[model samples]
Target chain A: MGGSLNINHLLFLGHGALWTIGLSVIALVGGGLAGFLVALGRVSPSRTLRLLAATYVQLIQGTPLLVIMFLSFFGLAAIGFNISPLAAAGASMTIFVAAYLGEIWRGCIEAVPRPQWEAAEGLALSRSQRMVKVILPQAIRIATPPTVGFMVQIVKNTSLASVVGFVELTRSGQIINNSMFEPFLIYSIIAVVYFSLCYPLSRLSRRLERTALQKKPALA
Target chain B: MGLELDFSVVLDRWRSLLDGATLTLQLAFIAVVCGGIIGVFGAIGRRGGNPLVERLCGAYVEGIRNTPLLVQIFLVYFGLSSLGLKFSAFTVAAVALTINVGAYTTEIMRAGFDSIVKGQIEAAEGLGLSKAQIYWHVIIWPGIERVYPALTSQFVLLMLASSVTSQISAEELTAVANYIQSETYRSFETYIVVALIYVALSFVMRFGFWLLSLALFPRRRRLGTPL
Candidate 1:
C-alpha cells in the first residue's frame, strides 16, 4: 500500500469539509425550527402537549444518532421508500438534533424566572405575546453559550454521518485510508481537521459561559 | 411511501434484542466504573503540584476530547494492531468509551474542585487533617456531589455513544440491530424496536443513577437538597 499524501487527496478533503459544513447547517436549521415547536410544546398550557413533548425528548435522547441514521437510510428502504444518503443523514440529524435542541431551549425558556411569566400574564398579553415578546428574547441570551458549545458537538458528530455513506470529511478520510492503508496518518489528519473546526467554538463557548456567569447573578 | 408497517418479524428477535440491550448496559456499566476511577485520578492529577503531571493530564484530556469517539475506537482497535496488541472488540469498545468519557469527567470534576473554597481546605489543615483525609472528606466527596448531575448525564450520553461500537462488531444493541436487519430484512422495524430498547435502557440508567445518588450522598437525603 502506498503511504502518500497528495494535492488530490487534500482537494477531496476540502470538498468533504464543505459538505460537512453544509450538513451541519441543514441539521441546525431544520432541527432549530422543529425544536422551537417542541420547546414551546414542553412549556405549553396543555398538559397533553407537555407530556407529548417530554415523551419525544425522552425517546430521542434515549437512542443514538447512528441508529437513527440507519433507520432513515435502511429503514426507509425497508418501508418501500427510496431515499438518498443526504436525505437519510439529514433526516436523522434533524430528528436527533431537534430532541436535544428542544430540551436545551426548554431549559432556557424555563430559566426566564417565574416572575417574568407572571408579569407578562398580568400585562394582558396573550400566550403567543408572552413568549415572542417576553420570554423567548430573554431565554435566547441564557441559551447562547450552551448552544454554541453544542455546535462543537454537532460538528464532531457529523463524523457519524459517514457510516451511512454520506461522504463527509470523515468518510472522505476513510476512503483515502482504504487505498493507502495508512490508518494512523489518515485518521490523524482527519482528527486535526475536526479539532480545528471544533476547538474555536469550544473556547468561545467557555468564554461566553464565564462572562454570563459573572454578569448574570440570576442564572438558572 | 404509502405503507402498512409490520413488526412481527422484528418482534421475533426480542430475545436477541434484550440480550443486546443487556450487553450495552453491561458495557456502559463497566466503562463508567473504570472511567470514574480514571476521572478521579485525572482530576487530582490536573490540580497536583507537579508541572509535568499537569501537562500530561491536560494533554490526555485534550487529545481524547477533541477527536471523535469513532476514531478513538478505530485507534484502540485497529491502531493497536499496528503496535502488535490484539484485543477483543468488546474490550476495545469499552476501553475507547472509558477513555472518551473519562476526559469529560475530568473536566467536570475540575469545575467541582474549583468550587471548593480555600477556607474549607484551611479548616481541614487546621484540624490536623492529613492530605489524604482532607482529599477524601473535604475535596472528593463534596466535589463529586456538586457535579453528580453533570456526571450522570455524561454517563447516560456514554450509554448512547456505546452504539458507535457497532462499527467494531461489539454485539451491543446497535450491532445486534444491524445483524437482525440483515437477517430479517426488517430494517425499519428492527431499528425502531432497538431504538425503543435504548430509550428504556437510558431511563433505567438514569433512574439507577438517581437512586445511587440518594444512597451515596447522605446530605442529599438528610438535607433533602443538593450539595
Candidate 2:
C-alpha cells in the first residue's frame, strides 16, 4: 500500500473532479436537447407522438441508471462496436436524463395557465407560433429552478459513471484508496469535494425557489 | 456476421436472482421504515424544535442531499470499520441507506408539514386539544397525506438506488447479476433481466404504496380530499 495520501493523490483527485464536471455538462446538454424534444412530443398535437414519448419516459424511468450504463457499455460491445468508457457513460446518461428532464419540463409546460394558451389562440396565432412566442417563454421561467435542482441530481448521479471505469471523482478516490488503504480518510475527502460541488447548486436552487415563491404572490 | 442473443444461461441462475431480489426488497423495506421515522422526527425538529436542533437537522439534510449515495455508502463502509466495528455488509448497507434516505424524507416531510394550514392547527388548539394531540391531528397525519405521492416516488427511487449497495458486495440483485454475468459471459442479457426486474419491482411498490395510502388515511378515501 502507498504510505499515505500525498499532494499527488490530491492532484489526481482534482483531475477526476474535472472529469466529473465534464461528464455532467455532457449529460446536461445532450439530455437537454433530446429532453426538449421529448417534452414537446409529449404535448404534441398527434396522439401517436404523445404515446411514443410517454412510453419512452416510462421505460427509462422504470429502470435503474446503473443497468442503463451496463447495457450501454456491454450492449454496444456485443454489437461489435468498440466503445470508450466516456462514450458509454455519456450515451447512457443522455438516455437517463432525457427521460427525467422530459417529465419535469412537461410539467412546467402544462403548468402554464390554460388562459394563456386560450389567449394566444384567440389572437389567431398558429400553435407552433404560439408556443415559440408565448408558452415556452413563460414555461422556461418556471422550469429554471427545478432544472437547476435536477442538475444536482445529475452531478451526484454521475458518480455512477465510475462504475463503467470512467475515472471520475469517485473512481479516482477508489484508485487512491486501493493503494493508500485509508478508505475512511480518502472517501471522506471525496464526499467533501462532492458536497462542495453540489451544496452551492442546492442552495442556489432553494434560493431560486424562494424568489419564485415570492414573485408568485406579486404576480397574483 | 449476425449477432445472437441468448438468455438461457442467465435464466438458469433464477434461484440466486430471486434470493438477491428478495434481499433488495428487504433492504429497501427496512430502510424505508427506519428512514420514515427519522424523517418525521427530523421534519418536526426543523419546523419547531430548539434552534440548535433545527440547525443540526438542516445541516444533516443539506449534507446528505448534496453528496452522492455512492460516496455516502463508501464513507459508511469504511468509517465504521475504522472505528473497529465489525458488521455484516447487509447491516451496513441498510444503515447507510437509512441515513441517506432519512435526509430526503425529512425534506419531503417538512414540505408536507408546511402545507398544513395554520387555521387548522389553531382550530385544533381552540378545541382544547393537547399539544401532542394537536401534533397528531393537526400536523402529522394530514401533512403526510399531502406528501404521500412524493414519498412514494422517493421510496421507489430509493429501491433503485439500493443497487449501488452491491458495490460494497451486499449480495443484492446487481451483485448477483455481476456474478452471473461474469460466470456466463452474458453481461448484456444479465443486466437486461435485472433491469426488467427492477422495473417490475417499482410497479409493485407503487401499487403497494397506493394501497397503503388507502388504508392509512380513510378520511381521504371517503371525501376524496385532504382531511
Candidate number of the best DockQ: 2
What is the i-RMS of every prediction?
Answer: 1.3, 1.2
Candidate lDDT scores, in order, read: 0.90, 0.93
lDDT of 2 by residue, B111-216 (tens): 9999999999998889999999988888999899989999999999999999999999999999999889889878888999999999999999999999998899
Superposed by TM-score, candidate 1 places the C-alpha of residue B207 at a distance from the truth, in angstroms, of: 1.8
Per-residue error for B170 in candidate 2, Å, reads: 0.8
The number of the candidate with the highest TM-score is 2
Clash pairs, model 2 backbone? none
Error of model 1, residue A153, in angstroms = 1.1
TM-score of each: 0.95, 0.97
Off by over 4 Å in 1: A217-220
Name the regions of candidate 2 deviating beyond 4 angstroms.
A217-220, B225-227
lDDT of 2 by residue, A101-164 (tens): 9999999999888888999999999999999998999999899999999999999999999999
Model 1 TM-score is: 0.95
